[model samples]
Target: MLVKGQCTICGPELENGLPSTSRFRRLAQDNTLVDGPSLTGYYTSCPAMDREGTTVFWRDGQLLAVDADLASHELFAMDDGQNVMGRTLLLGDGRVVVSLDSEVLAFHSSLSPLAEGPWPCGDANLRGNPVMS
Candidate 1:
């Protein structure tokens, strides 16, 4: 539930701090988000399904790790340790959904079965849904 002018965790702060011109930095400057940790896990652009897609990562709500950055805590990019599963579904008209299910953390979206929806399978929703497997 990211809304303008609200202080949410927009994403991980870069290891070296964001550039002055970065949109996320501007958002922080505008008081849209609080300065937060560089949560463990690398950042990746969401699938191009909507106008306001996000950079995705995995963070369980209970893991309040403030000292260690996400980059130092996981080996996801090397594929040497835990494997991560993530998916994104597009519901059309700027509705993009992201799911990270390694161990099922705090999921915020509602999911319909593949067989049931106002969005039909094989339609724009299916084709445009970007999945990060």
Candidate 2:
């Protein structure tokens, strides 16, 4: 599974049902990481994945798209100086929906939609799932 931290995104190799520290793939990193609030008005971090498995996340006020194998690229930059405070939505129509500190915006994504599934957009219950429990 993919994991997102304050300064790095990684996919860890599971060994005996546990993540192996030395075998994790470091997908991306941002030294100037910025914290963002969540829908509940608390600072949290989460990333969304499209149907095509391309991961999308916010870092340093920029929207990034990363593939499964460590290929990452910046998709968009938020110039309004607002933090993305919620989980991104990968709609069925190829649109990316994000909630910022002041407003909600939708951008056309080149990636495919999340369509329909138990874990569409990697959010099983339509919540960000910030806490593992």
Tens digit per residue, CA lDDT, model 2, 1-133: 3433333344322333222222324544543322222111122225566645566655456666766555666677755566447766666666776677768778887976552333433345453322211
Candidate No. with top TM-score: 2
User: What local distance difference test score does each model get?
Assistant: 0.31, 0.50
Residue pairs that clash (backbone atoms under 3 angstroms), model 2: none
Q: Ten consecutive residues with minimal summed lDDT in candidate 1?
A: 61-70
TM-score of 2: 0.55
Worst 10 residues of 2 by lDDT: 35-44
For residue 14, model 2's alpha carbon misses the true position, in angstroms, by 19
> What is the alpha-carbon lDDT of model 2 when measured against the actual structure?
0.50
Please give each candidate's TM-score. 0.24, 0.55
Deviation in Å, model 2, residue 129 alpha carbon: 7.0
